[model samples]
Target: MTREGRWSEPYEIFPQASGLFSHPVLVRISSQEIWLFYRKQQVGESISKPYVAFSFNSGVHWLEHRLLPPGIEGTTRNPPYVDRIRNRVYIPSFSVYESPDQELIGDSWVEIYNFFSRSWEGRMGPILGGSRNQVPIEPAIVKLTSNKLALFFRNASVEESYICLSVSTNQGISWSKLKNLPWRSYDNSISVQSGRNGKLYLFANSAPAGERLTCFSSYNEGITWNHPKLIDSGYSIDPSTYLDRQECMHHVYTSKDAQGTQRIKYYRIKEDTLLLNCPACWILEDVQESTEE
Candidate 1:
């Protein structure tokens, strides 16, 4: 937890041994109730399974660690969004399938979990057709209205790298075709969250293979994005929105150290700072000037 802009010491919530446990997605249902979903894969395995745990007191304690139902992989890279009004949790996830020729293919979908029944309510996608140049995976979702949602995907295409968008009007049952956004991201996870002030904030890697972290704000529910604000520069990956405070946005991502060790890092940026309408060229100029100072 963060207090007065200082993060507390990190503690372990889950223990894993003899396998790899990663891609954690934290969902806060209320001030007191929280849920964490992650992937667990054994050594030398090509496929991974999803597991979940609950934190009843704002993540102070985690309990009831269990595997999800058969065929249900939880959120892949981003947190699930909870619909308080309808009692539904929308999880954007993907599964990996190995071809006969030892090639791995990814299929993306949105799994709906019903809070009222405590069961999964089915899914809606394979949002992108298996195109050699597109290859969408790791979807991040943001609710636009009571019955509408927008999904942003990180493209895995090495030939053409760009983020894509898909919108759903009838909840998460159906979605529109995948379309390219103006921003560029390559094989990196992106995070999207709808702010309380009616704005959509997207965090992504601006460079082709993960060197810069940038935030883009959309005032019109993702139809258009304003100039991006540079958040950090380096090997930053898997940016996820952890919390939305009144004055700032809280994010957690992985950054590489000097020795190339991956470390979890926290970043907090004022919401108003990203809402500024400065041009990208001017912002780059200012950053260069500051570096020379």
Candidate 2:
């Protein structure tokens, strides 16, 4: 993390281990405290487990690498929505069940963790895959209203790949049937953020994969979305957004260098500027580099 919009030297947040670490999600609990949750798959293991590390000093230092309880996997790929008023963090996650003789099945759900108690309080669902044609995973959630929430998932289907949606009316306790949106996503992950001006924005890689990053805007709380606008190109994937205090939206994603090295890229655009621009207009440019690994 940098304060002056420049890349910092890459450093490991956790020591080397036997397994692989991937899908990191950072949640800021306070001005000085942040929690980093990620997936760890041990050697020779087919399933991944969730682990967390806490940074009490604004990500300068991280301590307490703890595995979450048996059932609760952390955010699959997107960041958790923090409800400060209720002192709960709603984590959009999923579970995968593998059968030796059968295919692997995946489903999406929401895990409610109470920050004050530091324990999981309630679980929303195991929103079934419904059919073998579509497998839902990597949910990105945003609040449409005080009582309504929208959950977007990557449809990991072999025959078709598109973004799907589910809605919750009572704080994620239950969800409506998962429906496919018109958007096509060859990339396996997506990020959604509710802008300051009540518009919803989604970021994902365009179809035919690794082509370009695209943004879709929803004006009616995600009932419908405008066509995607190009954000950047060149093998970018897994874009996530962070809205700062000044209403500037920070978009960070992974892009591959010429030699196939993965590099983190950063882009900043004012929320108001995005709101003012027409949906067909492109407003973002590559701003700076953050880290490379």
Best by TM-score: 2
- lDDT string for model 2 (1-293, tens) is 57996778978876666788888888888889899998889899997889999999998888898998776777755678889899998887776676686666777778888988888787777665435766787788888644578888887676766777777777776677666677775755788888654578888878566668888886666665665678886788878897788888999888888999999898899876654555543232212211211
Give all candidates' CA lDDT scores. 0.73, 0.75
| Candidate 1: tens digits of C-alpha lDDT, residues 1-293 | 36685658877675545677877877888789899998888789987778999888888888888898776667756677789888889888766566798555666778888876788787776575425566677778888734468788877666666787777776666676667777776667788878754577888888866879888876666665678878888988888774455667878788989999999888677767778864433111100001110
lDDT of 1: 0.73
Q: What C-alpha RMSD separates each model from the true structure?
A: 8.3, 7.8
The alpha-carbon deviation from the true structure for residue 284 of candidate 2, after best TM-score superposition, in angstroms, is 26
After the best TM-score superposition of candidate 2, give how far the Cα of residue 83 lies from its true spot, in angstroms. Answer: 1.6
Candidate 2 Cα outliers beyond 4 Å, as residue runs: 1-10, 15-19, 41-48, 98-104, 128-132, 145-147, 272-293
User: Roughly what TM-score does model 2 have, to 2 decimal places?
Assistant: 0.82
- Assess candidate 1 and give its TM-score to the true structure: 0.81
- All candidates: TM-score: 0.81, 0.82
